[model samples]
Target: MEKMKPTLTVIMPAYNELKNLRGAFISATGALKIAGISDYEIIIITNTKRDGSHDGTPYVAEQIVKEDSRVRHIHNNSYVGLGFKFRQGIGDARKSFITWVPGDNENIEESVAGIFRHIGEADMITSYTSNTQVRKWKRRFVSRCFTEFCNLLFGLRLKYYNGICIYPTKLLQKVPTKSDNFAYMAEIIIYLVKSGVRYKEVPMEIKPTAISSSFKLKSVFEALGTIALLFWNIHFKRTRIKIGSIN
Candidate 1:
């Protein structure tokens, strides 16, 4: 008998991405189909402005949920961090594995399909952008610096720390993450990798989008603080425990 394919739960976080939400959903579904993943579901987490206003993204997400039974929608009353949205999706995921795609339509269909194609080959699928020239100079500089800093601090050589990664749902749930901001994924990756979980790195390419929420001064400072705490926790505070041994 042929081997059964693994099921996946895709978490899409949309913050004022009215123009790209539907396209992102369609692209993700298409990529999943291309990768031969038939048993999968998408969870769209929609966010609005601090004043409880949006650009109709929530409505668009609702339409998607209505059009597809595999799609689920979660609306936030105000703007919450990306990490918070992902944590919510992770808790609600009902599949064997979990991954996230941004609703900004930055990730190309081929890259997404490539990531999914490597599913079940390792404990996790970590991706790195092959074409960094697509981003602005400042953003590229910041990203490079961040990746280098993470590698130095963690004593590992990884090309990227914040790309779209796939992890087992139960394993991710068992690991503890404290950051609810953009730096949350970095924290999770460091924890899991340091704990000796096997992972595979894949290359991805992204398209430039109209809006970017990651380069703000506030977000930069928040990420720095979170990394500092994470460094301390990993190097000094926590005991060395392998992820596979976690209960």
Candidate 2:
């Protein structure tokens, strides 16, 4: 039997992201090309219908599909949230490794190579965001408190939950999405910890422009909801299973 080539799947979920899709995709694929990982595909999932302002996300996605044959555009036919689109992208992935990069050009090019390099040793790899001075004091305090609470709640102290996550596709397939919204990332991380999957954290610098444009309040609520769900699973659910070491 011939050996099968390992594939890397990049899931980019977007909402009102027509302006950044092409740049983000070009940067990400360019970095991947430099890493010498030729077996890869980019899945762009858009939920523009729910954004309340027709930003022509779908049209832009179509244009991307036409321009980059390596990219696949998935329309959010049923769901209307970022989490839902991401879940669909993950479910459709047929690759050996999977990574999610924000569609707003936040993820740095160099970190993509770092993630692929570390994936050999860890089941999951996450990157930390660069500190920015433009954030409001209250937002910073809330994020810190929420992050600490997440560490305590899930026993996993990843610097940023949804910032940039890379993991084995099989691991994600084993423990699928429990929530269909923005809480999906948090739920996945908690599940990975509870399952004992070996994970690592690396520091990466995020673009200040991306940070300034992020939806902070909405992200906070999503994280809190994910933490609540994790507590429920720990104390009241029977989803515990052993995940092997990072050997």
Candidate 3:
């Protein structure tokens, strides 16, 4: 296969981010432009199923793309969950590097540039903020627990594996993405640990937002459950491979 242009393909998955979608793309694309990285593409995957129209995201994306060819928008007719959408976008990406920027716009331009630069040297680059300006206390606590659990289980202490992450496309190919929701983020981290890929962390400032739906107790539990499911998948699949060898 011909090598993809040395570009960064950013996948931003949205459920119903009609209000914040445009600004997110503008900021992201502008950041790359400021950094002089014109050879990049922003693939926005909008999952608007229950909304009055499925074309909301597509419309916004089209307007952005019209303004700049570097910006492209694709709509997911059927909501296949977060992990599935991320896989589809990254899978379709023709680039050397991949990043998943949240639709909420937490990852700003400077931070995006910083993270991408970090990924230039490392297989994976993660970021975190000691004071997440927009998140709730419960969400923060759960995030800390998840990070600690990952450290204990994988021996890698990454600051914020759950937020904006940039990695080489090769590493993503090596790791499987199975979560339907935000668990996809954690699953990626776990897979990286198992595959023994090189990784690094960077500090970032959390931009303020009044968005209340970003966090919920149920979502936290769902995230934890996703981690458990990943462990089960890994253990059972590994054992089956061993058994097949024996047979």
For lDDT, the strongest prediction is 1
lDDT agreement with native, every candidate: 0.89, 0.71, 0.70
lDDT value, residue 176 of candidate 2: 55
Residues 184-211 of candidate 2 have per-residue lDDT tens digits of: 7767877787777777887766555544
Per-prediction TM-score to the true structure, in the order listed = 0.96, 0.85, 0.83
| Shift in Å, residue 97, candidate 3 | 0.7
lDDT of 3: 0.70
Q: Residue-wise lDDT of candidate 1 within 147-228, one digit each (tens)?
A: 9999999898988988999998888997678677778998988888888888999999999854377778888999999999
Query: Can you give the lDDT of residue 194 in candidate 1?
Result: 87
Of the two candidates 1 and 2, the one with more favorable TM-score, higher being better, is 1
Prediction RMSDs, each to the true structure: 1.6, 3.4, 5.3
Better of 1 and 2 by lDDT: 1
- Model 1 stretches astray by more than 4 angstroms: 239-242, 245-247
Q: List the residue pairs that clash in candidate 2.
A: none
- Scored against the true structure, residue 232 in model 3 reaches a CA lDDT of 77
- Which residue pairs does candidate 3 place in steric collision? 82-180
